[model samples]
Target: MTIKEKINKFISEKKITHAEIGRGLNTSQQNVSRILGESGKVSLDFVVWLACEYPEIDLEKLIRDSDHVSIVRESPATYQKPRLKEKALEEIGAVLDKYM
Candidate 1:
């Protein structure tokens, strides 16, 4: 599933309303709806946070979609940093484990 699809699915599964997620993430409810339905664009970290929070969610697919949205589920965490090397980051993610 794409990132958007994963987010939508997760939101539905979690029974989280758009307004509720927006409130939790400090975003707009309309924006949240637009994002999941492919009516907007968001940053990469937001999508990454979604993947990290909802490990079962498929973010790769969502980000690759034509809509280009990176936002996912309504987890309270945030993406703090990005590394240059994929291997290094992968190792870090593995070591950190929680955000992987």
Candidate 2:
């Protein structure tokens, strides 16, 4: 599944609301709705943030996208420090392993 589809499915299965996601992302519910809707662009930072926020979700798989079709939009130089991003991802994986 695509990253958006995986996220939408997770949200649906978990009963998470757009309002809750908006609150977490410090964005508007409408914006969250748009982000999850068709034609909405899902940013790379958003994916990392979502994975960190919801560690139970299999982010590695979502990101890897075995079929290689989903293209996560990147915020220009968002993660200036690649190591920092790596660390966060490692932590997310550790958390997922521990919990799931």
List TM-scores for all candidates, in order: 0.47, 0.65
The residue pairs in collision within model 2 are none
Q: In candidate 2, what residue range of length 10 has the lowest lDDT sum?
A: 69-78
lDDT of 1 at 13: 71
Stretches of model 2 off by over 4 angstroms after superposition? 67-86, 89-100
Among these predictions, the greatest lDDT belongs to 2
Tell me the tens digit of each residue's lDDT in model 1 across 1-100.
Answer: 4645656666787787888867756889987787777766554555554554455443333544445343442454343334223433453355445443
Q: List lDDT for all candidates, in order.
A: 0.54, 0.68
lDDT of 2: 0.68
Lowest-lDDT window of 10 residues in candidate 1? 79-88
